[model samples]
Target: MSPSSSHSPSPLNPSTHPWRFTWETLAHIPTLRLYLFRSPTPTALSGASASASLQTDRSLLFVSLTYQSGDVVRLEVPVPRVLIEPDEEVQCVVRSDHVEIKLSLVLPVDHPVVIQYRAAMGFSGDENSVPISLNDDLKSLSSGDVNLYCKSCSTKLTKEPLRHILQMPSLNWRDVAENWFGNCCCSFGAAAEPGFSFEILSGPMYKSAVPNVDSCNCHDNAEGPEEVAHTSDMHDLNHTTSNCIVSNDPDRSNRQNLYFGGGFVHNDTNISKDVEWVEFCCEKCSSPLGSYPYWKDRGNTGTIDGGVRLFKCYISTSTPVGGSDDVFRNYTVQNLFSNLLLESAEDEVSFRTVVRDLKSRKPMLQLVLLSSKAWYMSGTCIENHATGPDCQVELQPVVKVLFSDCSNSSEADIRLVENWSTKCHAEEVYMMTYEIEELKNSLSFGKQSMPLSCNLLQGMHLSWLNSHGF
Candidate 1:
């Protein structure tokens, strides 16, 4: 998509302004990075709360958004209640574009975050202010005597005026944006395509053959009930054999595959010595976000360390070096990793299957084997064949069908507009048509019998897939 769609505002100046009077001041605050963000459940290991895991030694204040054009304006009030909602998204207006930015509500907002509402989106006229008397009710911002309420909702938010962590000067969003354009050579080559842009918050940072979070699948059924009981007893005999096989947190599967999906930039300077992984934070907000595996940990395939480059998410956050009239277009992990994802399909495990196990407190690796396949299908039926003048044929599925099988005996059916587009780019219109299969392997927690099945069925567009060497 053209970065300069009507959805995004045009370059503003004395005339082509997306916003004029109220938000014109924001053109001065510089570019603020808005990571494609969404909230998810925290892992038990991280004390699993809804918060960013930033670990900065220096007193830095920021996470990854850089500016390329225009300016930013600091709202005197605390971070508005509107930006904090998962359902409600906020955008930052830079140059001519108004792109969506993330709000890290779970992370402690130490001070006031700039209200770019007027900037990202234009004002709704004079109807936006509070009913309270501005002259009499207004109090000092620094003394903690005043409270800020959301323009959308009246709830009191914070006491800080400007975010405390970083008082650093905001950059010209256009400058950085342009730098990225040249860095990427061209926008498409950089893999920045329009889609839902989000930052990777958790799960494995780097890819490896032998992952620290290893999960296994049980593919065979025990011979009999007595045998099942015996096997269960034998398996229960040691945590090393069973518990580790099942691993923990089935939710991690979804985290690894679906949302926050991005690959690591090799030869990273920020990588930690820890074998399994290292961490990354927003260079702008100081919020700990991404991570990558050490070269040694990834076995033979990884390079040690260098300038870390993130490819799956939006590749360019800065403006072009020589400011191009073009606005920086938003990109997504799906578009960035499209080729690799199609090649990586398997029926090993699906989120729908694991979630059922989560509710039942069952291990996905107990005794199951999974295999999956997907494709586009069409079926034709003539509606009024007998009446030749009124004969017509129609396809039943308006969208594509994602049919999967889990636990051999169990199956799942899903519906979607397209395969490649389903990954965060569009809504999932799905239905679990089949009843979940009861575990035949699960004779008892002490025993095992059935090899469960997981059929991963989402496939790429045949036309696109074929061209990509699928």
Candidate 2:
């Protein structure tokens, strides 16, 4: 239920709410912060003409403010899950101007040392939030007998269901493992060069050899018998190496291939041998799907040989048997970013990060995680009354963060980012241009709902990025 006040309208009548407020609590923080905003009236009371009362009983915290005009605004917050020490004093600060009335409160510590404020405020996790994981989503998609399509145009992208799905190893898996174990496990062994090896050699063995021809043609007037023999040996070695590389390539194997990892999906099928590179797009709509490598470099994580790497964001899935078509549940831009940030926090063991544009490599936003688990309830306060009193406003789970916009970064901003990168080891997160815009919108909306005092940390804006969604 929304916070209650004596003269405030019911939660069902949100349109007449007279106050704008935000109540927030972070994990492990023993204090609860509540900010209330009300427009100042012509006859508003102040000084000796105004007074406020704060008290806690059982599982509820009650607040009341009385004006000289004999009007009273009261708010009640339910804290059933958090034990409040009613004996302790509560700190309430009120600031008023011709424009608005601002009220702030800091509650004392409860019995539990650490707690999620949302839980205390009577919000159940199951009803309010859904956590999505990238790996889990891919696995679920692979298991379903569905056809993939372009999200924008609904053009069929796959001729058939993906049969074999594999996850690509992390780009810096070895380095991370070594740091933890103090030695490389050698899981993939010393075969770092997966498909082929190209070597450059200089000597008399190539002095008489002609360049730019398919075969190494040697001049008869060039060298002695020993030099000629060396040249012959080099040519054979190069030919044998090329043959071995072609045979060892896994993509050439007779397996229906589809692999996903690192926020990308690859499709390998029906490719002609002569087509060395391709820009994958929907044939009917010609919407850009993804691109294929001109040549494969197994050393680079992005280049999967014999396949096109499609961005998951640009594709959709349809399962005819399930009667679900054009479903965009887990694939929304906000959901993807939330999961990525959660995963990155765990993988990098750091809460600070810089979000950059995937194509331009420009810093879009810099984020410092304040709390992985935070809950907040914010809305306008109503004065006009309605009969129904049972309506409730649900709290949302969010990743509380302090962020800075870097699109038009100044010299100070640049230095601040460099400090986080070097001193804090803040990891870098890359996203598409559109995805960045969506994330920025979410952050700004969250910030506006917060109290002015809670909206800034140092020079960065404090905001919330929803951690869970359907």
Candidate 3:
């Protein structure tokens, strides 16, 4: 009857291993199961034309489930296929030997989806797989200008506008003239009276402010006074603008004093004081009628009276009292030489009688030679043909010849003689052939004379006569 002999074990003393639990009690505890599934529909991968299929056995799904037996379990289940459409739904199913369960699966069709596959890993198992779109953004942002702006930053953009200028062909000279002249009055009118209404003068002529009157002169009542005044005013205005005066009117002599005024008079006197005067003499004859004073001597003789009378002198001034010196000097020299040579030659050869007489007549020839040395010393003839022999010469020095009987010699001979004489100074024999040709053409009948043999001064061995077939 004591407790030590009792068959029942005490619950507090687990060492006796007292109570045993039944299977029904263990089955009543909670347990978890996981499952995976795939849709039967087909799906297309990006950049691929064919529909993609899923492997039912190889495709996997991860699940987190708890069992009623107070245990946690993770399961990987195979999915058959994944369906893709504008909108579609897929579901997962979990089952055991006794009961079945279902849950909705979130497909990537709701947003952008990335499907990826990884090989079996370590103890952690394979990672979750997803579908991805490759190079999607690169294709979308390829072209056109892109403007970028920051949401929270202050930035400035600068804009520039282009300008263009164009010229038109319709513009004319009148526009330019008007722009230049403005409102200035034209030349030629009655002189403006004091207190006359005026405006500022504007034009190329007027440098300073001036009255808008027509002219400074107050000439009255001539013929067409207004026109004449206008013309005169234009002339004066032109003169003032050019800083000089030029006139050709016969009346200019009388009006010279008025035009020149006291300022010009003073200038003229001042200029005259600086000038030196020297007298020129006739290279042939020393005469006073042709003699005049000059500031400078050109050391040459001039012709006068159609070469019949030799004027040995000319006036000179250092100041520019006339036009260009070259023009005047050249004209004087040419006139003097041509007239003196022709006259002196005519006198010596009796050319006037030869021209007047037709029949052959004897000529009294008198040759007067003028040497370059004569200009430095007294211009006396060094060689005189009148005192020399009467025989015809082949070549002679330059001389002024006078013949008392020119009728016997033909004009051809006279021309030949002149050319031969002139060209001989330079030793040019080619001119002799030309003169012979001229003589043959002028004479009624005669054979051409051959040219003289001559040598070049610089190249003495070279003969121009032989080369020219002269």
Candidate 4:
């Protein structure tokens, strides 16, 4: 049900028919509500296996509604089932356990064909406002989370807390015991968003220095994407040039030099063997973001845990505060890292995304990483001071940390979620259905909520990923 102006929406027994009295308060626009059974133990979103374990009749159902004028507003609604029907009337009535919530899209859709865009929070349209770089906005922030979304598809990737990420899980853990004890469950609670917050962490990334002659050869040797001429209405960031902010820069925050990272485990079990690095790409577009190394670093965290390398920079439309958004950057401890507290999964490989090896028609397995459940945006602001000629202060977004556990998923039965090209693109798809019969392993069965959805690489995501020139 929609929120009331007098008070927040309270839980009401749907059988009592009290919602009719509150129906007058909701907006006139059409709304879509998704319902999912919340089992006592959290499970992934794939249909069959997850459904088997759930106590359907008794499980609680959380509801999240999205009001789309033109574009799809991807709320953080994680449900085992999604039912979409046109609005006959502005009603979302359901049974008591089948809870329903309503939250409209943040912006008003004026354009005839408005595809949602994930602009930095501070970049709102106000003529008097001075624009700052995303990097500048992030650095001055005290403590908060950042929302990481696909730039091309605007798919709401995740919202995570900066404070919780800065506090624990210092390094990427790789043990099942650690996974069982230290867990982060991504239950949306009354917060109507669909995507998980910090359970499956993602951040803006850059290309790694390591050379991969096969796909992305981006490294120190790689030049940035060509200049992207943006519209005048784009996020104006001329005021945040390094020269301007450097003079007023407070805290001179130490750039984080290292943090935990993860990737799919391949052959070359021994660290001494040639390292097999797991290259990370944008799920939608397939653009190379960074790499998670397969070899554990004995010098840093014990040999089994610290091996993945993350390229943390993605040159955007505007130049960054202190530097031009030109070259790709390697991850520094300042950008990401926390106290060297216990609990990380650097060795355990739970989920897998398989692609085909064109040379031999063999299956190539890539493990996914569980970073931080941190999302920052939607509330960041820049207060321009009238006293000083160009004084500006950055406001931090609200920070929240949620967790997920994928500890029980063994044998990896999650192979059914195929890549975008495999399902959508018929001729371009290289891997036939019969190729990887032996490796059709199901995910480890566990009581965790980390790997909720399998990301597909297709459409705008694929186009943007393949576009190195952009």
Off by over 4 Å in 1: 1-274, 286-290, 295-303, 315-317, 320-330, 344-470
lDDT of 2 by residue, 1-470 (tens): 32323443332333433456566666555555666654221122243122333434334344565554455555554332334444545666554311122222233222232224544564554333545444555455457564566766766654434433334333222222224322211112343212211110100000001111123222332221111111121212112322111122344322213222222211123232322333445666665554443323332232333234454545666633122443333344455565556766777667888886655566788888777777677765434332334334444567778888888888787777877777987777655455568788888787777545446778889887766632
My TM-score estimates for the predictions, one after another, are 0.19, 0.53, 0.12, 0.22
What would the per-residue lDDT of candidate 1 be over residues 84-140, giving only the tens digit for each residue? 334433343222122223333432212234234433454332121211121221121
Candidate that beats the other on TM-score, 2 or 3, i.e. the better one = 2
Each prediction's whole-model lDDT (CA): 0.21, 0.46, 0.20, 0.23
Tens digits of per-residue lDDT for model 4 on 1-470? Answer: 32321232222212222111000011122332323322222122221111111122322222232212221111122211111222322234333222223323232222222212213333333211122233543343223433333333433333232222221233233232124222211112233222111121223321111111122111121331111111111111111111100011121111111223332112212222322334445556654433433323322221222122223332222233223332222222222211110012222322222344323334343323222121111111111111213222211111111111112224352233234225533121112122222122211111111112211232101000000101
What RMSD does each model have against the real structure?
29.2, 14.9, 56.7, 23.4
Q: In model 1, which range of ten residues has the least summed lDDT?
A: 224-233
Sorted on lDDT, best first, the list reads 2, 4, 1, 3
Could you say which candidate leads in TM-score? 2
What value does the lDDT take at residue 431 in candidate 3? 11
TM-score of 1: 0.19
- Candidate 2, poorest ten consecutive residues by summed lDDT: 200-209
Best by lDDT: 2
Model 4: lowest-lDDT 10 consecutive positions: 460-469
Off by over 4 Å in 3: 1-313, 317-470
Q: Rank the candidates by TM-score, best first.
A: 2, 4, 1, 3
Two-way TM-score contest, 1 vs 3, winner: 1
